[model samples]
Target: MTELHRIAIDTMSGDNGLSAAIPAALLFLKEYNDTALILVGDESKILDELRKHNQEPNERIKVQHASEVVLMNESPALALRGKKDSSMRVAINLVKDESADAAVSAGNTGALMATGRFVLRTLKGIDRPAICAPIPAASGHTYVLDLGANIDSTSEHLYQFAIMGSELATAIDGVEKPRVGLLNIGSEDMKGNEQVKAAHKQLQDGGFNYIGFVEGNDIFHGEVDVIVCDGFVGNVALKTSEGLAKMLSQEIKAGYTKSIFTKIAALVSYPVLKSFRQRFDHRRYNGASFLGLKGIVIKSHGGADDVAFANAIGIARKAVIEKVPDKIEEQLQKHLVD
Candidate 1:
C-alpha cells in the first residue's frame, strides 16, 4: 500500500477563500484517502467553511492555526517576520518540521518563494532552485524554468535548470526524452546574447537533447517539451505569453458580445469554446514546482482562483507520489563534491 503523504496548505490567501478551495480539496480527499491534509489558517473560518460543505476538521483534515494572514501587498521579508504566524509561514513550517511531506501555497508568490527558500532550504548541489511553470502549448504542456525565480544566472545554473526541467517534463508532461530548448532571439546558432550562446554550448556539451535556440515564436508550437532561460528573460517570456493569451481570449469574448447574432452564435458554441479556452487557462497551469528544494514546495500563481489553488494541492500530492524531490537529489548528487 502506498503510504499516505501529508500536505500542508495555506487556506486563506487565494483569490477565493476556503469556500471554493475546500470543496475542491474535499474532492481530492475523497478520491485519495491515502493522503492527509493540513489546512493552515484562521481556524474558525476554515472549520465553518468545511461545515458548509458538510464536512468537519478531523484527523485527516488537520489544522495548524496561524494568528495572522499575510497580505499580498506586504513586503515578503517584513511580513514573514512581523506576521510570524501567518498561514503561509505555518504551512511552510509543517514541511520544515517534517510534519507534512509537502506544502502547497497559493498565497503571495513572493512570500511563498522567499519563505520556502528560507524555511525549507535548498538541497546540496543546488545553486538556486528555479520556478518551473507549465507552458500551455499546442501539444499538452511544456515545462519552462526560472519563471522569475532568479533574476540572473550563470551558464552552469541554466545547465542545471535544463536537466531539472527535462526531468519534470518527463514526469508531469509525460514527455519522454523531452526536447530541451534554450530561449533565444532567433533560430540561428549565432543569433543570441552571451547568455544564450553560453547556455547553448553547455547544453550541447552536457548531453541533453538540445534542440538548439528556440525563438519566442516557437514556444506554443509544441516544438519542445522543455524551455530554459535565466530568470530575467524567462519571467518576461512567461508574463508576456500569459498576457497575450488573456488578450486573445478577451477579444474573442468581446466579439461574441458585440452583437445579438454573435451572442447567439457564441451561446450555441459555448461548450466548445469554453472547453477550448479552458485548455489555455492559467488556472489549470498554476502549480510550478520549486525544483532543488529538499521537500516538495509548489509555488502557485498569486492571483489564483479556487480552481487554481485546489489544482496546486493536487500537484503537490502528485509530486510526493512521484518522489520528485528525491529524483532531483539523485540527479544532482553526482555534481556534489567532497
Candidate 2:
C-alpha cells in the first residue's frame, strides 16, 4: 500500500471560498487514493459546500475550523497582526505541527508568504524562501524561481534559488542533472547587472549543471531546466508570459470565429488548436512552491477555479512525496561546507 500523505487546504482564501475549494478537494481525492486532506475554514459553510456535491467529510477528508480570513487586499503586515485564526495561517500551522505533510492556499500572496515564512521558517542557511513554478517552454516545461517572494536578492540568495530549483527539477521532473541558468539580457557573461554577474560566477562554480547566462528568449526554448533570478525579474517574466498567453488565446478564438470560412477552418482544425491550447493552459500550472521553507507550502492563484486549485493540491502532494525541502537542505549544507 502506498503511504498516505496529508495536505492542509485553506478553504476560505480563494475568490469562490468553499465553493471552489471543496470541489477541488473532492476532485483530488477521486484521483490520489494515497492522500488525505484537512480543510481549514468555517465548518458550517464547508459542510454545506460538501453536501452540495453529495459528499461528507470522511476520515480521509477532515475539517479544521478557522475563525477568520485574510482579505485579498489586506496588507501582509496588517493581516499578520490581526488574522491570528485565519484559514491560511491555520493551514500553515498544520504543516508546522507535522499534522499535515504540506499546505496549499489560494489567498493573498503577500500574506501567505509572510505566514508561511513565519510559521515554517526558512531551512538552515536559507535567508528567505522563493516562489517557484513551472512554465511551458518550447521543448517541455522549465521551472523558474523567485517568482515574487524576494523582490531584491543578493548573489548568495540567487545561488540558493539555483540549488533549490535544481533539486525540485530533479525530484519532480526526473531530470538527472537539471541544466540550471541565470536569467540575463544577453548571453555573454558580462552582459548583465552587478548582481546577475556575481550570481553567474557563483553558479558557474557551484558544481551543478550550470550553463552560464540565458536570455529571456531562452526561457521558452526549454534547453534549461531551472532559471534563477531575483523576485522582481522572475515575477515580471511570469506575469508577462501569462498576459501573452491570455492575449494569444483570446485572439485565436476571435480570429477563428470572424467569418463562415474561418469558422469552417476552426472546426476542421479543432483538435490541433486544442492540443496547442492545452500545452500552454495556465490552469494546468497553477501552483507555485514556496521553496526553502522548512515545510511545503503551495501558493495557488487567488482566483483559481476548481481545476486550478486541484492542480495546487497536486503540487503539494508531489513536493511531499519527493521530500523536496530535505533534498534542498542536503544540497545547501554541502554548499555551505565548501
Candidate 3:
C-alpha cells in the first residue's frame, strides 16, 4: 500500500471558510488514495460542514479543534502574538509537533507567513522564507520565488532563493539541474540595479545551472526552470500574469458567443478552446510554498474555492512526498549559505 500523507488544514479563514475547505478536503481524500486530512478549526462547525457533505470524522478525516480564526485584514504581528490558538497557528503546530507531514492554509498571506515562521521557524543557515509557486509556461511550468514573502531583500537573499528554488525544481518538478534565472529588465550584462547585478555575479560563480539574466518574457517561454527575484518584483509579475489570464479567458468566452453563427463556430471549436483554457487556468496553480521553513507549509489564495483549495492540498502532499524542506537543507549545506 502507498504511504498515507497526513495534511493539516486551516479551515476557518478562507473566502468560504469551512464551506469550501471541508468540501476541498473531502475531494482530496477521495481523489488521493494515500492522503488524509486533519481539519483544524472549531470542532462543532467543522463537524456540521462534514455532515452536510455526508462525511463523518473517521480515521481518514479527523478534526482538530482550534477555537479562533484569523481575520483576512488582521495585522500579522498582532495575529501572530495574540491569536495563538487561531486555526492557522494550530495547523502549523501540527507540522512542528510531527503530527502532520505538511500544513495547508488559505488564510491571510501576511498572517500565515508570520505565524508559520514563528511556529515552524526557518531552516538552519537560511535567513528568511520565500513564497514560491509554479507558473504555467509554454513548454512547461516555471517555479518563481519570493512571491510577496519579503518586500525588500539583499543580494545574499536572492542567492539563497536560487539554491532553495533549484532544489524545489529538482524535488517537485523532477528537473535534474534546474536552470536558474535572475529576473531583470534587460538580459544585458549591466542591465539591472545594484542588488540584482550583485546577485547575477554570485549566481554565475555559485556553481548552479545559472542561465544568466532573464527578462519577464522568459517566464512564459519556459526557458528557465526557476526564476529568482525579490518579493516585490515577483509579486507584481505573479499578479499581473493572473490578471492577464483572467482577462484572456473572459475575452475568449465573450467572443465565442457573440452571435448565432459565432456560437455555432464555438460549438465546433469547443474542444480545442477547452484545452487551451485548461492549459492557462489559474485554479490549477493555486498553491504557493513558503520555502526555507523547517516544515512544509502551503499558502493557498485567500479567495480560493473548493477546487482551488483542493489543488493546494495536492501541493502540500507533493511537497511532503518529495521531502522539499530536507532537500533545501541539503543544498544549503552542500553550497555554503551566503
Q: Each candidate's lDDT (Cα)?
A: 0.81, 0.93, 0.92
RMSD of each candidate? 2.0, 1.1, 1.5
If scored against the real structure, what TM-score would every candidate get? 0.94, 0.98, 0.96
Candidate 3: the clashing residue pairs are none
In terms of lDDT, which candidate is stronger, 1 or 3?
Answer: 3
Model 3 worst lDDT run, 10 consecutive residues: 329-338
| Model 1 clash number | 0
State how far residue 91 of model 2 sits from its true place (Å): 0.3
Compute the lDDT of residue 272 as modeled in candidate 3: 96
Q: For candidate 2, lDDT tens digit of each residue in 1-338?
A: 76689999999997878888999999999999999999999999999999889988897899999999999999999889899999999999999999999999999999999999888999999998999999989888999998999977999999999999999998787899999999989987668889899998888888989998888888899899999999999999999998988898899999999999999999999999999878878889899999999999999998899999999999999999999999999999999888
CA error at residue 161 for candidate 2, angstroms: 0.4
Residue-level error in angstroms, candidate 3, position 83: 1.3
